[model samples]
Target chain A: MSSISLEVKDLAINLSGNQVIKDMNFKIKKNTLTTFLGPSGSGKTTVLRAIAGLNQKIAGKILLDDTEIQNLAANQRNIGMIFQSYALFPNLSVFENVAYGLRVRKEPKATIKEKVDAILKTVNLQDKEQSYPENLSGGQKQRVAIARAMVLEPKILLLDEPLSALDAKIRIELRNQIREYQQRLGITMLFVTHDQAEAMAISDEIIVMDNGKVQQQGSPLEIYTHPQNIFIAKFIGNHNILDAAQLRSLGVELAENDKSNFIIRPELFQISITGDSSDYMAVSGKVKNISILGDRFEYRFITENGLELKVEFLNQQQAFMIETAITFYVKKDNIERVGI
Target chain B: MEKHIDRIIAKIVITLISIYLAAPIVATIMYSFAKSWVNTILPDGWTFEWYLQLITNSDFLSALARSIILGFVTTIIAMCCFLPVVFYANVYDESIKAKLRFITVLPFTIPGIVLVTGLVRVYANLPVPQMLVLLLAISLLSLPVTYQALDNAFIAHDFRAMFEQALILGDSPIKAFVKVVIPNIRVGMFIAMLLTFTNAFGEYVLTNIILGGNYETLKIYMYRLMQSNGQASSVLTTVYFFFLAIISIIMIAIMKWQGSKKAEEVEDTKKL
Candidate 1:
């Protein structure tokens, strides 16, 4: 199958009188799942609506497979979107909902039947082909919704918080199915989610946003290990954000004007018994709290200089549980500096 | 003991309210079938002679026919025009909704006498038929109920999302509305139509004031019979009561049909 790429350039959206989405640009690579990761009201869903041409007052060029489609009507764009509500026509049975687009396009009856049947099977909703949306469980309704969209064979599928409404078990289970389907079909998908774990699990690349603008866009690991700003660091993990002055007092290498903060992961801090103190900056602290997290142990500690710290250790050692006066070591190489 | 008393008091209040509301209609129904009901609290005699006398009158038949025709046509006009208008106002032009709310309440605030007087003074010189004017007037009076029904139709479900989803699935706005929106809001539209029909059917003041002798509706026909043929008029009233009862049954049937159709299952094989 041929590949399709979607690129948005300098997109700005103004709703009523206020600007909701500022100048935004992003490219969804071919056959890759890229998620717009942000909290609610961060303009992520606004971007999805704009791309679908539902928000007409957008100023930008949206190019799909090298053709500008900003002027196209929503129906004319041929982009399939899975709404958060699933939005399955309540009056329509599962079969009719899947056959709706095909019927609108005036496809042959037998072909519509075959395609709808196959798609329903693909989503594991064949048993529910006769049921209405209200009669089905939340997971079944979502699968029918997916089957309805997938049967259309659109160029790109836009999922706007598709799994956010489901329970934890169904969400993870269905999202993994969607990811597998994305891989099998090699379909270009731009999934919008507020969950960092969801983005990390499903996306080939994740675009993190706070306000309207993109905070950081990269692989989940690249984003997690090397957050460009304090927002991304604070958002992605439970890392301790220490300012330049605090780090300087701890005697890490830095210039005089290094006023920016630094991120230290919990797992990166080590006990001085295993590592040489000459190579790593060593500090002793009072253990404030300790909690076991299955495979890892988390400790809240306050140093002599009054800097609070959270450090996680592998469950292989219970010795740290009793050590309140133990020294912790942090390598200069492991300290990640924030650019902003 | 106190809680039991509270429950008993609540039940008594509810039963009293129900009887109070039902008493007038019960009295009216009893009066319509009576031979001489004024001498005592109980009706003097129950007879079908008034009904037989009512059906034999050509004027009564024509008035009944006229009222039904007008009510049906007015309901069709209201639904055909107002449903789309409400849908558009809700989905596209929200500003028009404020105007619709004002117009819906206009019929209720202005007395029917005042409205008829204004309309007569305005349309007195026009060459149009008085029947059409009355039909249009009755329909206008039913607008508030129709608009509210349509509003509820859109609001009670995920209508906006369904429309947008259909649009994304390659349906034009019109096609999406007719095929997707119309079917889903079918129950609401039916209710609005029924309300409009009942309003037009039972309307008296406006019909009498504006188009009384020229295009006599059932209400005007009954009013005339009250003086000339009181028993026949009572018979007409009984028939009208039955007509309304039949309509109510039909509305309930429509509601039941919608409910049953929604819960039905299609037997598709090739289960996964």
Candidate 2:
């Protein structure tokens, strides 16, 4: 197994007498991109800030390469951070902004120029070295911010929703660029975002948090395929979840009620003619609505017990009419059993 | 049609009010330049004699120099003393900020005469120079204005961006303040300097009471000249007014430049 690049153990953060992060623990391996994924106000950003040493009142131990650094100031931590706002120096030219770290370390002017030039080229900002931050586009500003952080070559790079402020197209473009840059540099990175798709797109591993606690932590496929609890199942992707009692009444034997949850991804449900199929769990429902989503048709249905379920088909040609009574089959293996 | 009529009436009213506000300064300048005109709506003749006389007066020259020096000194001292504390309060502890804000404004809200009177009584026993006492008084009075200007600047800044970038770049707080915060809020700093300079230049009561006629600022020169009541006094007033007008023009030019720069930035961002 790869050695841990960064580790947080029983970390807690309180702000103005309110607990924001509670006993959060995670370990990120070297040369990997780890993401903290959660909704707004879920303390994901707070946890990232704690790791960066931006949150002073944080409790518990944070180890960077096996060295305890929880008490270090943000500058002393040597952790590069890209804020949601990009945080580029408005007055400085792109070159100066990127060269700021080297200058602060008292590097010789020649070396500063060489490193800054190289890093600017790395972020595709070499042509715009003379541009002030205020004159740059959102995407360009984000790149500058990235370059500014990367030039320091710190232990870990912390990105606090860096692409959240960009337009959808720009966000996608920047996200891919960031992932490519991270891969090229082979640096450990902790990316924080509320968007699951963005997190899943780049993360080697993702920690889904909710209400100040870690709900689940795993690789993208692991999280999508097998969430550890209901929150994770709901948070990672769209899911049609039902209580064990409800699943049991549908001829699905749930192993336990108090500790397990029945979760089926929206796309996992199969629409077909009713038949005796040992390898699949079947349910009968009336289609309530149909949405054409280009490549797929999303069907919303109401089960006999009033549970709402969403099922998707490959095309509108496969969609059943509204109010049509049908049985949806979920392959048994695809029906994930999550323990809370 | 009715709305248009109302708009015309409103414009006229605004124009008249603007004229009323500006008339006194215009009249002052006219009287100062008039060769011998008196009790007339317009000057009988225009001459540069008053302006010339002001150039030759040694006492007037000394007072003008003192005013400029005091203005520069007071603004420098006020900014150095207040900005760090204000920036700290703004960033770290907001609760303490409220109390500090109150303290900074205490000198402004209290009646100037009363405050100067108290200062005189208290400082009479101290073995400080009269000029030092005068500088202290002017700085104290100007602190509230300077602090407010800087505080507003801090509010207008993207502080999260400032700190985050600084951290990522491994910059200490002081370096960040010098490089990032100061440049971003240059307009605000300029306005603060102008305000402090104007306050110290025009301040009369504090200087009068503090120096007790030993030291003279531009305002004191004008006051002394006003006692004689003639072209000399008018010339002194004109000199003071001209200096203030020059400062005001410079401030406006700086403000306009900043605005245009901001607009250019916006346009550039849009293009991207």
Docking class for model 1 is medium
Which interface RMSD values do the candidates have, in the order shown? 4.4, 1.5
TM-score attained by model 2: 0.90
lDDT, candidate 1, at B128: 76
Best by DockQ: 2
Tens-place lDDT digits, model 1, residues A1-340? 3354898899888988888888888888898999999888899998999999898889988998888999999999878899989899988999999999999899999999999999998888888889877677766877787788889888889999998977789889988978998998777889999988899899999999878898888998999999999889888888989998998777776799878899998999887545566678777778888888899998998888888888889989764654467788888778888877
Tell me, per candidate, how large a share of the native contacts it keeps.
0.77, 0.80
In the range A1-340, model 2's lDDT, one tens digit per residue, is 4499998999999998999888888899999999999999999888887888777798899999999999888889989998888777777899998888889899999999999999988888889999887778887888898888888888899999988877799788989988998999998999999999999999999989999998888899999988898888888878878777877877776666354578888888876534558888888889999899899988898888777888887884656899999888888778777876
Which segments of model 2 are wrong by more than 4 Å?
A254-259, A273-276, B1-27, B34-47, B89-109, B118-137, B155-157
| lDDT against true structure, model 1 | 0.85
What DockQ does model 1 achieve?
0.50
Best prediction by TM-score: 2
Chain B TM-score list for all models: 0.79, 0.85
Considering summed lDDT, which 10 consecutive residues are worst modelled in model 2 chain B? B156-165
